[model samples]
Target chain A: MKKKFQNSKTETVVYFICSLVGLLIVWQLAVSFTSLQKVMPSPFVVLGFIGQSLTQKIGGKILPLHILASLKRVFVGYFLACIIGIPLGILMGCSKTGKAIVKPIFELLRPIPGLAWIPLAILWFGIGETSKYFIICVSAIVSIILNAYAGASQVDQTLVGAARMLGAKPAQIFLYITLPASVPQIFAGLQVGLSSSWMAVIAAEMIRANEGAGWIITTGMESGNTVQILAGMISIGLVGLLLASLLRLIERGLCSWNIQGR
Target chain B: MSKVEVNHLTKSFGSLKVLDDISFQVNDGDFLCIVGPTGCGKTTFLNSLVKLYDIDDGEILINGEEVDLNKHSIAYIMQEYSTMSWLTVKENIQFGMKVRKFSKEKLNRKTEEVLKMVGLEKFADYYPEQLSASMLQRVSIARAFAVEPDLLLMDEPYGQLDLELRFRLEDELIRIWQETKTTIVFITHNIEEAVYMSQRIMVLTNKPTKVKEDFVNPLPLPRNVTEEKFIEMRNKVTNLIKWW
Candidate 1:
């Protein structure tokens, strides 16, 4: 059974690589052989530009530096979201009063996209890194809080009862049972929140920034440089994929028991 | 080990009463199985004993005073395998002891002993999800036994397992009980299991549950189910619980 599982996993990775290569081939062929090149750059051109931009400057900064700036923004916003949202979510799920107090306002704000806060963020914090961080934080905090609440609320009451009967005090029960039980859900929230943070940072940077991936795209658009635009977009896609994979690796470490056949 | 005295315990949800003025006593280190018809509030009775549910009337005393979990060592195994899914088998076994602040030396010793008792020492590093249903149940059993509680309340902990596995686990439970001599109040709908495992049997009536009878089992240890007296006692308890 273990061998079969490992074989399937290897097969899946191979298939994934094949599919991505096939998509790139199709994209490259469509641009080279058709009128599509009039509007879109070939995948090869975009790929070459991305490789060159790693060392060469795109907008006074190398691609790596621009990507690094965006990453730093995402890190700050995501960290703040986790520290605030996790505890708030657990409080809402664990305490009726906490839920009653925080849930309505959270629900009201939940549907408003993080980009929607860009204007207000600029107005409040003045078109600076702080405002960008605020927008990203807003974008990420919703999913973080929601998932945390779900995780905490959905904790198996039986386990809590078992813990209580085993001489776990209320605090101990919350620490050992509630917190651990909510980990997978919290991680799920973190994943979504992270994606949202990336999206928010790009948008925030697009509105007004000299450095970052979003600025690369906006600058490309202004100069009508389709290759640069495509390169920036691909860079964002690759970085987002890398970040998500990193998150999953961390989750696998913390929540190995949740994964089957491990 | 601890003595349990439940006096005139009554509980209700809205207007429907579940446990109605039920009373019972369990001596220290005694194995008592509570058997009743479905929906007869057997679980509610167990919950009340552990103060998981507030009794609308009457009291439960451990030794002499009110049952306080802080003062008394207790462990409960529910019908569901309440193994912590995040912990390995060994860690799950250590959970109760860690919560109760058992010394590290004692916790390590008890964990190893209970893991071996349940024959799960091999799967000590395995998570609950990787184990089969019976193995998961054994993890729960090991966790409960690791505490070496003054009282162990089990509500049909083996209800989900197949008969063969259930019989095997039942024998394991009996061996552990005999070795540790922990006071146990086990609730099960299985008459044969109750008769086989308990030194005394308490049969309860259907809803608005009252104790129909509480009597000692005269059967010897390492009993054979096919034995004449064993079947007689099993049938006797079955007859008492038969609502139909």
Candidate 2:
């Protein structure tokens, strides 16, 4: 089993490299040999644009600073969602009255996408960072709350009974058994919430932001520079990948006893 | 004073009556096994004793007073593996002691004692998912014993194990019971296991469960299953349990 795991790790790296190379080769060939190059620049041109944007200003701020601005909005909104949503979810899951009071409203609003909330967010908080944060928070909180509720509600009753037999009070059972049991599921919610947060940030920034990744892309489209547009998109993709990987690392660290962690 | 007495216990689930006027007593340090037919509400009876389910009538007294879980030290091992998955084997064993608020020194001592008793000292750091079925059962048993519970209730804890593993665990249970001298009320559908493990066997009727008979075991400890006396006693209990 250990050897199989090690082999799979090596295989993943090999496969990832091969697929990336395959994509770049196909892209380069399409640009060199086909009329597709009329609208789409070569991979080298886009790569050079990204390289230059690292130091040069896209909208009065360098690429890293633009990325940072968008990230700050995501972090604020995502953290707020986590703080409020997780507790509210757990409360709803563990108590009948809590579920009754909160569930209907949550379900009604659940289907509304983060981007759909943009107009309302702007109407309520205007085009400032607060509106951007509101959009991200609304988008991210849904999954965070849902996952936490599922985790808390799905706790095995048998363990709860065993804890009771071992002389645990209700509070002790919740603290020792219910809380630990719900952690893996809460992490699952966090992963989904993070992706939604990233998605919402781009849409939020696109509304009126002057110096963010979303603004860079919107401005690039206006200026008719496909290379800059592709560069901004590429940065979003890279940063999203890094955020997911970082969240996974934290999950594994906290849930080392879980099979996924192992 | 550790004696448990149940008087005319009756419990019903809405329209269905599961337990009907059951009555029994378990003396201190006595290993009492209750054998009943399948779906005879053996688990319901155990749950009622632990106050997991409220009874419709009668009373359960641990000594001279009513059974209060908070006042009495009790432990239970369910049919399913109840080891906390997020905790390592050592931590799982310590959980009950921690809940009971044992001193740090006594907690460490009891943990060491139970782990060694169950032969799980080396695998102390392994999680429940990493351990095999037999090892998980051992962890549950160790966790139950770490608190030095006054009354230990086991509801067919070995029901999931294979025959060979079941016998090994049964012996391990006997060793622990003899050492701790704790009052035990074990429920099982397996008549042979009831006869093999218990000092006294209480047989219950099929639905609306009632005690059919309670017989003291005449066979000696270190019982051999193939022995004529053991087989006779096993067959006697098996016949008493005939419902289907």
Global lDDT of each candidate: 0.89, 0.90
Best by DockQ: 2
- Candidate 1, A1-262: lDDT as tens digits: 7899899989989999999999999998998899998999888878899889889998789999999998999899889999999999999999999999999999999999989998888889998899989999999999999999999999998898888888888999898899989999998999999999988888989768999988998889999999988888888888999999898888888888897313
Candidate 1 lDDT at A197 equals 92
Error of 2 at B244 (Å): 3.0
lDDT of 1 by residue, B32-140 (tens): 9999999899888888888878889999999988989888988888887788999899988898888778999999999888888777889999888889988888888
| For model 2 chain A, the run of ten residues with the poorest summed lDDT | A253-262
Alpha-carbon deviation at B33 in model 1, angstroms? 1.8
Runs of candidate 2 exceeding 4 Å displacement:
A1-4, B162-165
What are the fnat scores of the candidates, in the order listed? 0.87, 0.85
Local accuracy of candidate 2 as per-residue lDDT tens digits, A78-120: 9999999999899888889999999999999899988898899
The parts of candidate 1 lying over 4 Å away from their true place are A260-262, B162-181, B220-222
Q: Model 2: per-residue lDDT, tens digit, B1-244?
A: 2789999999999989999998888999999999988888999999998888889999999986787878898999988889999999999999989988999999999999988877789999988989998789888888998888889999988877678768877897788788878898999988888888899999999889999999898788989889999989988888888877
Candidate 1 lDDT score at position B189: 88
Q: Which ten residues in a row have the lowest lDDT in candidate 1 chain A?
A: A253-262
As for model 2, its CA RMSD to the true structure in angstroms is: 2.0
